[model samples]
Target: MSEKLKVGITIGDVNGIGLEVIIKTLANNRILDFFTPIVYGNTKVASFHRKAIGITDFSFNVINSADQASEKRPNMINCWHEDVKIMLGESNSIGGKYAFLSLEKATDDLIQGKIDVLITAPINKHNIQQDEFNFPGHTEYIQSKTGSKDALMFMISEELKIGVVTGHIPVKEIAENITKETILAKLRLMHNSLKNDFWVQKPKIAVLGLNPHAGDNGLIGSEDQDIVIPAIEEANEMDVFAFGPYPADGFFASDNYKNFDGVLAMYHDQGLIPFKQLAFHNGVNFTAGLPVIRTSPDHGTGYDIAGKNIASEQSFKEAIFAAVHIAKRRKEQDDLLANPLKIRKLTKDRD
Candidate 1:
């Protein structure tokens, strides 16, 4: 419809496989056909990665600013500072600072609308902390930077899409975190994200219980009965199609999960264990309810496999493709909304 949407990518934890995945994913010509990708990291690091991986066809056109980035072509669009000399698979304060700086640069471009969507690679959580940067992960950092309270992390695949009610927090804090207000907020974000960002109309979502067997009717724990159920009831009363208090143990084992469009887990591991098991190579970690689109590979910075040139780029490729599809669908929906008659006729044809 229009020229490809420009996607700004931040190389996460340059010591890890972030650069490798970007190199491998961009090597495919079909990616250029969908969106013009711009990488916001050190051009030197990317060049080193390309050489180490034996990829020679690709090249990055370094630019001083996002405005200088060519919308007509796929460019690396260097946002390089220092730390370009850091060794791979090793963590240092310099690497940590630049990793965070890359994210900040991408955020500025995102807010300015120079990039339609932002896709981040994995960054080391521990190393990312500097004197000024205190956020735990990308999700929290984005939420804080954008002042968005409802932002949540969602891991998606063709079969299963899971969202965490509480993320990047300790297990002891999860039960205390479960509340009617929090669950309702997350549910609304998930619903809006499905309808608007993902283009899913009337999306059905399932909620998982915090305790085993959903607190076994309160014998095992009261959080599921007192916290999760009431939140679900309130959401249902609001006409949201949410059903569950399912035990994390057997939810993925049964066919029950196949009926819903997405699953809302109580916390991180409760959701990720099954998601990684099913779609580790191709799963995408998407942050929902952001003003801008954002996605990353479901996996993290594999320090052990960092410069091996063997890390599979499947998930990164899937993330980029998903971003492109969602961005296109959102634009199309906006156009259709602008033309009501066409939308009505399409609805009539479907009926």
Candidate 2:
């Protein structure tokens, strides 16, 4: 049997449902069969969450570092040894402080090749802002850390895959940000990600317009006609099978998204609103165009029900699964590339 992949998980916020979901997701021993789970956070914090959730049987094997992670057990690396105050269901600076610590520690290891993939739990964007950790979210942070010039906020699910041109930016700034170069860059990222990361043979990507009804052909706005349309043409000229500056409303309403392998939205909510509405519980946020593989649950910290034991771990679990699958596929592709003649011979034999 092949060796199991090592998955490094970061505790988002001690107060939020991050720990709760992490514990719940790792409770099942069956998951250990595919990946060795290494959690970067305080074990005491994890214990607090495990007990609060009324999970009496589940416990983590506390270790000093990722090198000691066990394949058959859920292992935790304490990011800090100092005692932390548990403030469940609250967003505060303390929560943000520790969230950053956990993320930094795990990500440092990820950069050093200590872990195969990283699955981050939900973190409150507002509270998690600091001098060193100043970015829109995890996607931007990871991008900067890994020196990736372009990264796509790709949302993946069983049904549809969506990418956004503008992520975590204000609505008013979105218009100014949607340029031909930017749109074309995002299209390129989405197209390549579909082909490389997701293994779509011939990815047909659907692009959405910035203005409502796709600018009504310049009646509503000219960005779609002037900028977006030309960018789509450029992508096609470059041999990317991309189509449409489709009206966001009608495109999703008529089930048009189902016809394409991927959808490219002008902004965040344009894609996520419909995606979350459809696959809220199963959607996985994948950071594409990065040297490292990272995935996170689609939902945020359930602050309202942090300690109520009501938070579902389905999305978090799916994020872990997605990270594992993508990492394995990437390795398989790499192995195939190492033996070009074998790949070509396999292709010829198939034909």
Task: Please provide TM-scores, in order, for all candidate models, with all chains considered together.
Answer: 0.95, 0.98
Candidate 2 lDDT over residue span 25-90, tens digit each: 999999888899999999888888988989999888999888898888999998999999989988
Q: Model-by-model lDDT, in order? A: 0.84, 0.92
Highest TM-score against the true fold, candidate = 2
User: Using alpha carbons, what is the TM-score of model 2?
Assistant: 0.98
Tens-place lDDT digits, model 1, residues 49-88: 8887788898877777766666555577666555467687
Off by over 4 Å in 1: 71-73, 81-83
| Residue 182 lDDT, candidate 1, scale 0-100 | 93
Off by over 4 Å in 2: none
Q: What are the clash counts of all predictions, listed in order?
A: 0, 0
